[model samples]
Target: MPDTPPEFSESADSDAVAEDNEFDSLRGILADGVVGAAGGLVGTAMMTVVFLIAQSVGAFELTDFAILMELLGLSEVVPPVLFGFLLFLGGGMVPWPLLFASLKAYLPGESSPVSGAFFGAAMWSGFVLAFYTGQTGLSLVLYGILTLVAHVVYGIGLGAVFDYFETRPDSIV
Candidate 1:
């Protein structure tokens, strides 16, 4: 057999597991491109998915949770769900502006404040949702404070994600 160079010669995908685990691959690309973007989508969707499922199973009604029991089902959930949907839309849009702004600072491109603001808002929304979920001691002060810090971090994730791709051109989502 021409002295067979090696039986276990490593191949490009030799270590790849034999499963249709595309989600991880996609997530890795997305995270590398935008950490929060990928993480946010997965996290938020997971929560909302569970919530929606619970609604069908009457999970909201089963607990002593006031928000679900006391508040208007149609009204309360709708606003927040809509609010979250808007945030996700904004989430998708947040990073590019910061990326371009970075371009303005170092590279050559138009920097957009609107994009930055959207990015900030999306990040803030994550924190706000967290506080909103707590029924015992939900307060505006907590929401406001957390929102401010999270927004800044969200913007950074955008820039970092974009930059990561710059260095790793071989990467793809």
Candidate 2:
């Protein structure tokens, strides 16, 4: 028999356990960022579906894409719609996810999805103000409702992706 009991021998101090956890390592942090980006991309796709449906019904326009094209002056270089979409996807896949990850701790929720939904709602307020299309009457109302729903859906998708990765036994996060 060993001198130390197996139970006590393998036990670690709280500090050691905390230090040894995945998030403390650089590799783990990078892994989490990649995972978060994937989640954000998924979320963006979900939001795009909502916008596409709205566009089909004439309730919405590709205002964001147009704005991006104008701001970047990429209209002459490439098709405004295509360039705008690529930019949008890039934005969704990186910065937004990074922001979400940074703020996840402060957002109120029992799970990532709930917190993400809150984050999306918060983001929508800014978007509504910044991207106002001068819509009025019922058009404005529909736009508001649809955009809000889309943002919430995006958050859910983002959070679901995080939740999925986190639940895996071999997850880096």
Candidate 3:
């Protein structure tokens, strides 16, 4: 006996629900991407600090920035530290989070620290090993070890931050 048809009202309700669901899905994707990027930045920052400390203590004696500068033909134009910073931001901070977010499903241990550490090792194998193994000198071995440790630390930080943010719906909103 209502003025409105029952079919019209039912369809409207279903449409609203569908729209809400779509919005939620989009929001989730956005949250994941943003959180993952932030985590990567943090991890890279921590790695940088660790490397600096190692250098100061004479435990490590490699300059990846120097190598990078030479490779890019920027050795004459820019200092290694400056170039290194840019590389760290771009290479370590930007890509890692996105990579983690994309590969998280396939990574073992359900986003835990262990899984993150494993992911770090995977990254080392894929990126670090491929790039650094060809370099010459005793520093290479020391640098390689230091880089391995740093990458693992980075992974832990990346995973922890992502997981923390992922679990908190209110934080994303």
| Tens-place lDDT digits, model 2, residues 1-173 | 47987668766577657656757788898998899889989999999999888777666787567677878887878888778888888888888888888888899998999988998898889777766777788888888888888888888889889888989988867
Error of 1 at 1 (Å): 61
- Scanning candidate 1 in windows of ten residues, the lowest lDDT window is 60-69
Candidate 1 vs candidate 3: which has greater TM-score?
3
* 2 against 3, candidate with superior lDDT: 2
Local lDDT at 146 for model 3: 69
Model 1 alpha-carbon miss at residue 36, Å:
12
* Reference-based lDDT, residue 19, model 3: 52
What's the lDDT of the predicted structure labeled candidate 2? Answer: 0.83
Question: Hey, what RMSD does candidate 1 come out at?
Answer: 14.6
RMSD of each: 14.6, 4.5, 5.5
Model 1: per-residue lDDT, tens digit, 1-173?
A: 44555755544363344222543676664544464355334334443443444345432221322333234454355555454455544544545443444443543223323343355555556545643544333334443544454454444444454444445745532
Question: Which number leads on lDDT?
Answer: 2
Give the whole-model CA lDDT for all candidates, comma-separated.
0.44, 0.83, 0.70
- For candidate 3, the per-residue lDDT at 37 reads 75
Poorest 10 consecutive residues of model 3 by lDDT? 127-136
Q: After superposition, how far is residue 22 of candidate 1 from its true place, in Å?
A: 28
Among all windows of 10 consecutive residues in model 2, the one with the lowest summed lDDT is 10-19
